[model samples]
Target: MLYKNSICFISFFFLFFFMLINFFFMMFFIMENMVLFLEWEIISFNSMNIVMSILLDWMSLVFMMFVFLISSSVIYYSKSYMLNELNLSRFIILVLLFVFSMILLIISPNMISIFLGWDGLGLVSYCLIIYYQNIKSYNAGMLTALSNRIGDVMILMLISWMMNYGSWNYIFYMEFMKNDYSMKFIGVLVILAAMTKSAQIPFSSWLPAAMAAPTPVSALVHSSTLVTAGIYLLIRFNNLLIDMLALKLLLLLSGLTMFMAGICANYEYDLKKIIALSTLSQLGLMMSILSMGFGDLAFFHLLTHAMFKALLFMCAGMIIHMMNDIQDIRLMGGLSINIPLTSLCLNFSNLSLCGIPFLSGFYSKDVILEMVSMSSLNIMMYYLYYISTGLTVFYTMRLFMYLMISDFNLLSVYNLYDEDYIMIKSMLLLLFMSLISGSFLSWMIFSYPYMIFLSLNMKLMVVYISLLGGMLGLLVSLMNVYSMNKFLMSYNLSFFLTFMWFMPNLSTYVLNYNFLIYGQNLVKFLDMGWGEIYKSQGLFNILKYYSIIYSLYQLNNFKIYLFSFILWMMILLLMLIL
Candidate 1:
């Protein structure tokens, strides 16, 4: 009862207070040196020393404010969402642990501390994903864990690599050895680790799969905790690690990731999976921009995206709850009438996500697209960026129609109502942030705004792509089984896109097939060779059976003598002939 009522409020209030303090610090740092540091020595040895460090800067402070703000709101939201569960306390504790680990990751400059936080985020995320204890959640959790475990290994290797520099504080030496072979080696390790955490390309399957988690966790995971961890790491190490070679590769991979995730979201039917894929798409955009050495732009987009994405997930969760946990978009329509406030919030967040002008997303994404246009990059990347941007609108509008514009499609009673005040209150907080964060961040992050020069055609390219995408979305959403069922007509293409380019299939079944077969063979061989023969009970039973056979033969000596005489005569004849 206390947990259901008070724990969230306690955490929420405290985190809100801390957010204010951090925001002030962020402003101060921006006006001053833009970065500061603190260190606390934990231990020292003859040649080795351990120190814990905190990185306090405008960037870190801003990230901390967002993390604290989003997590607090998420915790508050979860209290109402998970009210009926028996293990509510456990869920709340895990959420707090997740936040603590994220804070560790956000502030730490020391490699050891960062590793602790990095590994902690992965471990806690696995626990949260399987919080429901179902087979689906279990499978999702395993996929999430093993995929992230690769990043943990890479971080460990990086920690050892840094040992040659004689300090566990990676922040200290990133600039000093930026061009050395060992440093580039470190960059490779960092990029690999960040890729797994951020769900780029091959690791992307886990991001969507992780939707098996509770929706509040989704709000946190997608917003600031799990997926953004990688982007944040890359932002911190951008100048230190990523070179031209790494940049080109990252740009290519992240651009594909953006395109792939956007297409999947458009084809997706599950409400939460669509949102999850949307987060993946946005992450890719951030990574792509960062790869071009625009770390500030990436971070700007990251903060703004976190605001709206959290609200988006919350609104989706509210609707899903009203629908009795049904997440299929096909089952939902005309919700805007029944749940006006919730629907309004949902669409606004969705619009922000589509980068509608003046919204938080618009300020960041417009700059990113313009930056891409002006930069000296190849035609493929330019095409990919715009095409993916349009796809974002396509999915967003498709989802909008399915959620709000279509006729009512519910089979059960329509319980969709904007009555959950507790949930609404937290969502309103994020809605306010998503509305203003981008504009505020744009003015604050830079002393002078970015002046991008482009021809008129290129300047309007985003508007053009968005309009085309909106038309595609409208067409896709309006098509019915009686008119045009794309799923059935082009089932193969739909299946391929919806399956996230068969990443899950390749990652799970195809990749593990030989290993699973070998394991099965090993089990069979062990049981047949050693286990079958060496068992005490089996050995005793065999001896007893043979002794019984011998006793029976002795009792039947006359019959045995007749058989033996015939055998002996044949043998003697053969010997004589020889």
Candidate 2:
């Protein structure tokens, strides 16, 4: 209790501090259209320097304020969610470290200092993911850690590549390196690193698995901070990646990721996992937009998405907590009756996620769709984005129907209350932000509005997709109850869509199975066969043979010794005579 109170106080204090700083920075930017770059030398060696620096522009300030705000909210939320846990202090400490790491990454302009935060995020996330001390948590932590390590390794390589420019400060060199063929590999590496951190297609399995963590961690790490690190990194490096071939590949993969995650979320039953997949879908959206050279739009979506996604997770936490830790949505229905406030928050966040007009998600998502429509993208890319957009609405509506409108499916005679003031208080803060963050950020960030000249259909593209998706979602939800039993029973197409086209299986079993089998074979050959023969058994045999020969030569048998000496002397005499 003492520790929880301490954490809550500290979190509120930091929230106030960062909010004030953000206000000042916003005013400063309004007065002068220049970035405030502050640096203090940490270490300097011949041609190798490491300096701690701050890049206080509008982007960093806004993002930092968001991070601090979300961190503070999650910490406050944990006060009730984790009040019963004995090791609450440890959890609070880990959360604090994770937030600090994110702030470090936010301010850094140098690759060397960025690495400090990058690696810190990966390491600390692993600890938080496994805080439950269960096998599931262990497996999830390993998956999350190893997946992020790929990006960390790429960052180290990027640092080495940047060293060729005589400085690790990428902010200063990004524009100059834009056309340098030598820096092309660096750009590719940066994208690959971002893919891993952002949970882009191939690296996506870890994000859902990371739902094994507590809800507060899910809200903070999965929804906002840890996963966004990659997107944030790319935003900082967008100048160099604008014209690279790698960006085209990123666009395609991110589109596929967006579509894939949306389909999977519809199929997922676990409440937290559903929200996790939604985060994956939004991440893909951000990456796809970034690839299209609208990095500001991507960053805008990122900030808005964070506000609501965190609230979404917090609401899910309340549901899970009330349900006695049951996460299956099939067992959850009519929550609006028992927990009306939480239900309202969930519905609001879900609608926002579906890009409902005037909400936080709509501001960025609607603009992104408009921008993509106006671009010269290929037909296939166009379909991927629009289809993914539709799927987002479909899944969100389906989730809302399951948890709110449908009849309560759980056993009767149970308490389901929303009287936890601490949890509700924390959620109310984000709920208010989710309502206004999009328009607020749009007005703050865009001094001149986007020049979105388009045909009528192009202007309404997002609206068309969203309406179509909402209708389909309603049909699917209706089918859940009213369809013929046999028809509903034989849902092969739905099966494919629900399993995310079997991506989770492909990632977890197929990929890892092949590697593990090959690894076992290699271990057998090295540890038991040729390696043993040459390195252990063969050397042992040779040493034994030499020892036996030496022992025989040292034998004190008179007749044997005399015979050996005579034979040696005769051989020497015969050689001399010859």
Candidate 3:
């Protein structure tokens, strides 16, 4: 059963069944508006016990449904995408491992338990990304693993801090210590961990570089599982994080992350990398909205974005297959004529991603934009929010033009086979969901309608900017390569955009890039220079060498030396006796 037949079919049906179960449970809990908490003590000793706790609520149930939905789709799609690969079983196993970790992370409110799931996600993600066994993939995996370890360390520190404060269960403690001044430090540590895990500005390089992984893995990871873990944590901990001073800093950094990713996607040519950047941009939106004290909105966007993003990546994988694994968007076009079904899925998913009207992404993206416009946030935030929204449209339109509307630029003969149907089946599942998941989820999530009051012009601004970004994208894509390069385009700006604000150069494996360099200089100065001179071993070595040289003089007159030594020994004894 494990190897003779299709493992994808088995896992797909299993996860799909549970996803429906979760959806039912989520609806029941929402209707009742109740949460169930269970704790079992395995080893009890004093105040601390080996008891792990589990929380079941509508929120967790909804998240689990989305996770299962996307994961099953990805696994089934991988069946066709990886048909020739020898280790298909291993790939399926890793995806299941990640889902388990994500479920662990979601239901546990204890810091100690969260770390286990958190670390598991990091470990499994690293393994999946480097599944290719190449230099680039290995380096990307290292970056992903090393960057996430910072968040893991933060969680460990939080565990120690919480243990000393009386309980490992954060839910109980957080509810009790809502307004304590001492909770600020905990908030700081928690935000740091979330930022690292979510790939906010400084930690974002790994997300794009992670495109080295197979496209199916990208569909699972970048959509709802790995990157969303941090957003989930923040949502779980919003009680502690709200009204803190660090939240303002988070707002600014998250806005910058959104703006940066949006701009970089337009400049990027790699199809997977463009999608990766879009994920980063959406992550920034979630974090920013969460920082604004709307966990519900963030969670809303998270689920909706997951549906469309997964479908988008799956369609990209299908196209990349048509291009013989060529991810360069410049060499792709007119796919609608060939694979009409895949192209339709890709186009709808892209529109959903662009927040086009009535699509799944629109329900979330529109709410977020309206919320941003209505909030009394600072001017800089307004600029970042609006401009980034426009840039997202720009990059998405540019990618669509390069892939669908432009001429068919593939040099090789394009062919479609029967195995391609496996991918289409899974794609259709997600494709149907992506179209309607947002409205259904938002209706289920909010008890009452959101009240958004704005002038006609303010409402039109979002539409106007989106149209402008789209037109600009079309114009730029239509320009001849030499003409576009020869015009006002500055090579320096292009290079900066290419490298994503030089973040890779700035993010070190150990932690901060600055700290990495600072440590080397510290070692060079203290441990190797002045420290060596005063070290006991150094002084002893120098004295030994000099003593050996002095022994040569003693050899000149051995008897005289012996007599002198004997006299000195006698004199020392006399002085001691006296």
Candidate 4:
């Protein structure tokens, strides 16, 4: 009991301390020229020096404020939500640990520090996901941990490759890359790491599993912190990733995933699952922008998505908390009459999420579509993008209308109007910003002089059409449940259903095969005159499935035992005969 109480006390102190430091530093930076830095004790090895950079920049400062603002509010929101929980102290500790790692990730100047924070963030999120200590939550945590480990390994390999070629310092990597191909290699691997981290397509299953976590955790994981790590990685290395084929591949995968996720979200009836799928779709849009070499546009969308999604999720949390933890949208109806404030905020955030004109999502997402429209990308790629934007609207509105004011006629046995003050305040702040000022932030980050480029009527038409498609979906949602059921049954769309199930898996397959495109690379098989031991099937799937076999065959077995006279003589005889 004392230990638990002490943990609670320390967490409160740290939370207060974090906010105090944020306000003070933000104020000081506003009034000063140089960012204040402090030196701390360091560890060393033989002749290797590691310097910690504890300074702030515009980018780091913005992400820091984002972290502190969201995390502090989440902590406050958790108070009432977790008031009766037994493990509140442990929860608080994990939340604080997450906040610390996020701050460290954004501000750290070196790869070493960035990775330190990266690992910490992953660890804390894994713990939080499994906090309930249930079978399902444990399974989800394990899967997500494994996926994150893959991403971590990619990042580590990239760092190691850099170390082998030159200095592993960030500044040094940047300077050293001006004339080296190694940068391209490292950039490709880094993008792979980002894709896995961002839960882009094939790596996306971990996210829905992550929903097994508490609602506050789902909000943090989906919106601002863990998943967005990939976008940050890309932006941090934009110069290296730009104009590369791998970059284009990333864009394509992101766009396809976004479109696919929207479909899954449409099919979903679970409230949290809907939002979870939408998160994947939103991040896909951002990654698509990144792939298109529009870092500014991607970053802008990321910021907007973070605010609205966070708000939507917290509102979901409040509802779930009040209703004794039911998440099915099918079981919810007429919530607008009971929780007017939360419903209103939910609608506003959903509107932003759907990218209605003048909303936050509209501003950022428009810039991305506009940029892709102007690029030299092929028509098919551009069309995929167009379809994705439309799908975004369909799912966002479907979730909103279904959850906020459906005609399901389900009865609630729990109260829905507690309106805890701290939770309400946190949501209200997010609602105000999302509704009023998120676009202004976009404008600041994405201000580029208008260039006279050819008008992309195709892209523009796609956007309008996609927007209309979403409106059509909303109109359909307004129909009675019987009609919705009839429409679904009449459609009898096995392909769509199968696609929804297979798309995420397909994405993972692509990643495993190194995202190789047909007509780009081919694998060959030769069996040292062994009478065609295995058919050299030209299909990619078969070849990829046999990579291990090919690798083993390539080993230099003779070099393992040169002193074996019989083996050496047979090898020489075979070579002479060949």
Candidate 1 lDDT over residue span 1-578, tens digit each = 87567877887888889999988888889888667788786899997767779889888889999999998899889878998988887888899899899999999988789999999999999999999889999999999999999999999999998888988777777887888888888888889999999999988899999999999999999998889999999988898855658767988999999999998898788999999999999999999999999999999999999999999999999999988898999988999889999998999999999999999999999999999999999999999999999999999999999989997788755556788999999999999999999999999888776889999999999999999999998987887733465545577766787799999887677877898899888777776656766875579789999999888768868978788889999999999999
Off by over 4 Å in 2: 43-49, 481-495, 518-578
Which sections of candidate 3 miss by over 4 Å?
A: 1-4, 44-48, 417-419, 509-578
TM-score of 4: 0.79
Q: What is the C-alpha lDDT of each candidate?
A: 0.90, 0.88, 0.88, 0.75
Query: Estimated TM-score per prediction?
Result: 0.91, 0.87, 0.87, 0.79
- Best-matching candidate per lDDT: 1
lDDT of 1: 0.90
Model 4 agreement with the true structure over 1-578: per-residue lDDT tens digits: 56555665456556656756765665556546345544454767888756676657545665676666667667766766677778888798788888888878887766778788888878999999999889999978877887888888887887788786555555545654644788888888888888888888678788887899988878777888999888887887887776788887887888778877877777777788888888988888888878877776777787788888989999999888877687887778778888889888888888888777787777777667777777888987887777777777777767767776675455535566845876798788778868755666654443356453556675466568666767867876787755665666655563455246665456445555563453234332243222244454335457787996767556866654464667889999999999
RMSD of each: 6.6, 5.8, 6.7, 13.7
Best by TM-score: 1
User: Among all windows of ten consecutive residues in candidate 4, which has the lowest summed lDDT?
Assistant: 522-531
